[model samples]
Target: MGERSDGDVVLAACDLVVAGIDGPGVSALAGVSLRRPWDEIQPLLGDALLELGLDHHEHNSNEGKALGLRLMARRTLAGELSARELAAWVHDRFGHGLPAAEELARLDDEYDILEYDDRATTDVDEQVMAEVRRITS
Candidate 1:
């Protein structure tokens, strides 16, 4: 996590769907321990932005709204890095469509956050996990 002089760094992964894949699209914030120095994670953020296969075309379907990575870095009192600063950085980097990530809540299972909000959340996750296991096995 990018610990800013601010506080605990929080990250929400961008929803990913392989462009032409008909089944088993992947989505979730797989847990990661980002204990690297800010200098390291900073540039890595750019690389992550580049890897999001989202389509931004106005004519694109609902997927066009998929966000790039939400970088959550806490700034220290030395004030070298702060969450407030990350807000502006996120906007400038990912465009206005992306949220500043200022209001995210913590969750124990957040790494498995589902993209779907409907009643099928459990079903979707189970199906995807099953598909993954089947392929990998």
Candidate 2:
């Protein structure tokens, strides 16, 4: 793929964001970092993390709790299951909380602009380069 203007920064910071946000890209970016030139990548990473965190808090807040209870009540009334069972089921199926749409939007923005060029550097290439350098020396 063609190089992206912000590819390095995105690649560098993706790992932290993924670990926090539980997104699909998490696995692809397991160990990225914002070292050196990638330091500028922190703003994007921080924005995403902060947004996701806030969304999680909101999703688990008092209002959210009430909504969940209400939903469980309706389910119980319909003879679906007991309140406790419903709660447990919801928790397991939908997670304890959710990220906000704004946070998700920010993530989308970052991902859209990200440059994925030169993502994989094989050890074979490293070995070859080293061997070539040794021969030249």
Candidate 3:
């Protein structure tokens, strides 16, 4: 739970490179632009959105469509690609196409409750997990 290094994150700009996307702090980053500051890579991120076929209006592109958003949702939730840092960026660019930072925070909060609630199963948490799976799937 220490602070991650710059290469620890699988950023939107680094979507082309899948080395460290398995989780937070998972990738050495090999050869990617993640080492650069976010401002320098913002344009690359915009290209990623376009490459995925996602627009400012829609979540999925026509090529694979559902797959990219699903990857984004699941990887973020798993702490791989990450969402917290890019929430504002994603919102400012993609709008409803991707989850905003607030939604990501809500999901994280619900996930934390699921981990420690001591219930056999909370219906709400199950629903949230289901949503996570649905989006990821």
Candidate 4:
């Protein structure tokens, strides 16, 4: 493939996150700043993450949690959702408090300089990339 556009990088990073990869892994895979807030980025990383979560939930057999995730994902993509709204939903569902402040700080602190690897794209990456292309197109 040629050089990845910004949208491609954001989509790939979102896919990596949904595939059980975290900040560092996504940064390495996409060679970009995954630590930046989604709102700050052009493609909106948070929206992509939520969308992928919804897709994952739909394809898997998990029903209860998947339903909730799909709802939140839809709300997010519709631009009708907020972090506080998601936090409230999580709290209501799981009865657990959200550490918003700490998590925000952690997000900022998670940046790392990763060496690029041409062979980084696995079979799953290709599948996710195809899905991303279909969605974005």
Leading candidate by lDDT:
3
Q: List the residue pairs that clash in candidate 3.
A: 23-80
Candidate 1 structure quality by residue, lDDT tens digits, 53-92: 5433332222332232221232212345342343344344
TM-score ranking from best to worst? 3, 4, 2, 1
The number of clashing residue pairs in each candidate reads 12, 0, 1, 0
- Give per-model TM-scores: 0.19, 0.22, 0.29, 0.24
Cα RMSD for candidates in order = 18.1, 26.0, 10.6, 20.3
Candidate 3 structure, TM-score to reference: 0.29
Look at candidate 1 and tell me the lDDT of residue 105.
Answer: 18
Question: Which has the higher TM-score value, candidate number 2 or candidate number 4?
Answer: 4
The candidate with the higher lDDT, 3 or 4, is 3
Model 4 stretches with alpha carbons more than 4 Å out: 1-62, 96-137
Candidate 4 backbone collisions, by pair? none
lDDT of 4 at 100: 24
Total backbone clashes of model 4?
Answer: 0
